[model samples]
Target: MNLIKTLIFDFGDVFINLDKEGAMANALEIFEVDTFPEELTHVNCRYEMGLITTKAFLEFYATKFPNLTQGTILHAWNCILRDFPKHRLAFLKKLQAEKKYNLILLSNTNELHIDWIKNEIPFYEEFKSCFNRFYLSHEINLRKPNSNIYEFVLTENNLTPSECLFVDDLKENTDSASKLGINTWNINPETDDVTQLFDVNKRLF
Candidate 1:
């Protein structure tokens, strides 16, 4: 609605396709570990919280599989990297040009995946420039769907939750924002095209 003055977008599946399956498969092979242990979720949480460096993550994996090299673990961790769709970027750029809302990117991302983006994506800077503020979870030391993160964004941006529209692929992330009065759009990137959420021309205004 017209009350929405800020558009907070999630980076991963919302704007890009992440190869989780590929990453897991690669991790299994490279780590020489039977599979990702249940503790992996906790480890990933710590990584996203910036508690552990990329090297530390690799070392942890290597410790589990003595035969695995640092390079192998790093590569396995990076297997989730993928290309950002040009059309989606063009849409975001168009939104920026419209100046209708203050655009912000809020993502729970780690250094390794971000490094891959910098190297693999030619339009990384251009994509970044579209947002008024870019908040990476690791950099901020906060990750969704943590309510503290939602509060942090609101307080830091001086944005009322009601005036913000949070778009994310994950239900839990949006749910957290929604609880704070932000409008939410759960964009299913797998089967749904994001551009159809609103007409590019209309949003440009």
Candidate 2:
């Protein structure tokens, strides 16, 4: 394997555990709908890309579910986010201290989810500090599984794809990176831990 000079990581499921299905169920229950509205999905995409403001995103939901309060909508929307493990933080810190690879965090996250993380996770800043580059989809106006976003990172960093290793919980995101000649690890949070990165991917190291 080629020497890995850079490591790109996904936030959700890779570092922080996400209850995606639970959050979906919570939203459906709060909206009192059997299925998610197509319009809601469209608005969500725009919101994730920062094309819409948080107020506008909430207002759209408020209009759809007249009986639900904004607070309730916000709760359901943020339910996907869960705890960040201490072990992973320690591992990242170790990596940062070593100064071996350029660590980058590239997450498909939005304003609300990030807000929740800021308030809920006391060490959010410390975790972020470990990374050389932090790229949030909403803040960057780019998202995963899209070649442009990956290309932007490569171009901005002057990184060679073959020397970068991307870790993501989503297969699609990793698959996309792989197409560009980057190494990828499709992590399964159920059985995998980010703290075990070096041990798990020993071949790469």
Candidate 3:
């Protein structure tokens, strides 16, 4: 706890509530797919990493699912995002005010989703202001569960992995960071909240 000088957080399911299951169900129903095919998955990955423009990304979907309207595609894409709790912002602001540790926000998000958030969440800029560094997978072209993304954060910030605590909802992502000697908390979004960070990870905090 004492050694941790940096706190790395995942945005989705950490600060912002995401209806992943519901969104997936919606997408499946809308797209008429039992599961996303590899091509769609690959294109999604590329879009997240900013390998393609939003126009191109939307065009891909439109080309494939011509019957579906653009609004429907956009709706299904952004549906995963839900309300962001203000208590989490309060906690983060307090942490920032204390100047006790470096705060960083890391998330695998694409342009449309971020655009939607910025437009929807009135306090989006305020929330972003709390972090020393904010890395979006689309902006950085590096998604987590991939070790290099963690490595890039460590290198770019000149942070010692052992001195940093990375919190994410996914085990695979935390595991990747953990392998680099970073302290991690694989939080279950259903049962945990970032506001309880210090209390939840007593050993680390």
**All candidates' TM-scores?**
0.90, 0.96, 0.98
- The global C-alpha lDDT for each of the candidates, from Candidate 1 onward, is 0.84, 0.92, 0.94
Per-candidate clashes come to: 0, 0, 0
Give model 2's TM-score versus the native structure. Answer: 0.96
Question: Relative to the unseen true structure, what is the C-alpha lDDT of residue 142 in candidate 1, on a scale of 0 to 100?
Answer: 98
Local accuracy of candidate 2 as per-residue lDDT tens digits, 1-205 = 5479999999999888899999999888878789999988889988999999999998988898888888898889999999998888998999999999999999988999999999999999999999999999999999888999999999999999989999999999999999999999999989999887888888888
Q: Estimate candidate 2's alpha-carbon lDDT, on a 0 to 1 scale.
A: 0.92
lDDT-based ranking: 3, 2, 1
* Candidate 1 per-residue C-alpha lDDT over 2-102 given as tens digits, one digit per residue, 9 for 90 to 100: 76789899998878778877888887776556877788779988998899988888778778778867777677777787878999999899999999989
List candidate 1 segments past 4 Å from native.
Answer: 29-35, 199-205
lDDT of 3 by residue, 19-118 (tens): 9999999988999989978998899999999999999999999999999999999998999999999999999999999999999999999999999999
How far residue 128's Cα lies from its native spot in candidate 1, in Å, is 0.7
**Higher lDDT: candidate 2 or 3?**
3
How well does candidate 1 score on lDDT at residue 50? 92
